[model samples]
Target: MRQLWRFGLEQAKSCIFAVVIFSALAITQFIEISFIHRYDFILIICLLTQLLMLTSKLETWDELKVICVFHLIGLALEIYKVHMGSWSYPEEAMSKVFGVPLYSGFMYASVASYLCQAWRRMDVQLMKWPPTWTVAILSAAIYFNFFTHHYIYDFRWIFKAATILLFFQTIVYFKVNQRTYKMPVVLSFALIGFFIWIAENIATFFGAWQYPGQSETWEIVHFSKISSWLLLVIVSFLIVAMLKHIKGKDNGNYV
Candidate 1:
């Protein structure tokens, strides 16, 4: 068991070279002239790269069980939601098995970002008044999530419902700790959001999805992905909240 765990850790702990290459390819596509479809494997590459990077860090690998469960539940929920038009993607960017889009790849990346953040924030203290903090985090995340060049659409009620569901999921997952929680929770979400936004931009260029031509890209610094990171941050929180709930109930880390 220990050997297997160690091996998995190694797999998830590679370098960021793949992520860099993937992003470069993606941005290249978005910039090069012409309108032909571009094939991009950035998200998948990012997923694999993150997995290896994470596996190399056994501490992060410890969250694998939780990560797997989070993806399973999320894929199920998303499949249902997509059918209902709550959200969507390119018709077949993901493999479908048993009437569901195989979203484990995306979920894995999302989970990894949170795991990275949580691991980084482990030593901090939780706050007593987390509401203010949570809201502030939410506001920042929301702003960037929608404002970013990834795929900002104001489906108003659609997003509102999704955000509400995510917020409740947060409550269900995390304990109301008064100390050491703030930094870790917020930072974890922040990093996850960051990667997610980049992943979205990659997808847009790859033909996995696209924004309506009417929309204008929002520029922030040299890194236009800031806004998208904000939304990804929200996703990280939802996943963390769910994991916190499940793990707390079972008194186990993963399975």
Candidate 2:
């Protein structure tokens, strides 16, 4: 029973930031603050919440840098995707640029924040890690495909297969109290991707963004998007991996 409780507590601690962001999305939908755009209001809440987390030492400077990088990367993708008519923000907001709101970037930053928190809190380490050059090349291709798919044949399935081929031997070790547990790195990506898809559905329901089918009425996001999330998890994972791998090397604990 005590072990179970410890497990639950660790889970909550790792996920608290994501929970807060999702709750903010859900809560913003019901708020009728007339003094500002709803998107802007959410932006204020998210920024302030992030600041609070940092000030309270819940997040480190390195983690903040990772979150910021995701924010910029996500914002760039948002601009292009919105322009491509893949999805859109229907509401007007002062913080919007090229049809993408700044707060939308925070949504992506939240994912990076979760990863950073989870990595530290759980004492995660990688085993049989692929070469950094290989990871960089694959991650770059995965990110490029997100944009190129509209204009060219989508090679996401190929990339998906590559992820398995490359990392099948890789394991991620994480701590639970004095005990340690491990899982295949690919499984970690899939699990995180699944949860992100679930969160995406909730975000859409809360009017965070809308698909064309959802322009008139809210509906569940397509399950197929889970594959996209899986690929994106790879991208996000690679970025975080570089930082963790460096630390692991410095500590002489990883290959």
All models, RMSD in angstroms: 10.8, 1.4
lDDT of each: 0.45, 0.89
For the record, the alpha-carbon RMSD of candidate 2 to the native fold, in angstroms, is: 1.4
lDDT of candidate 2 at residue 226, scale 0 to 100: 99
lDDT per residue (tens digit) for residues 31-71 in model 2: 78789898888888888988989999999998999999999
Query: Can you give the TM-score per candidate against the true fold?
Result: 0.43, 0.96
Q: Give residue 24's lDDT in candidate 2 (0 to 100).
A: 79
- For model 2, which pairs clash? none
Best TM-score goes to which candidate?
Answer: 2
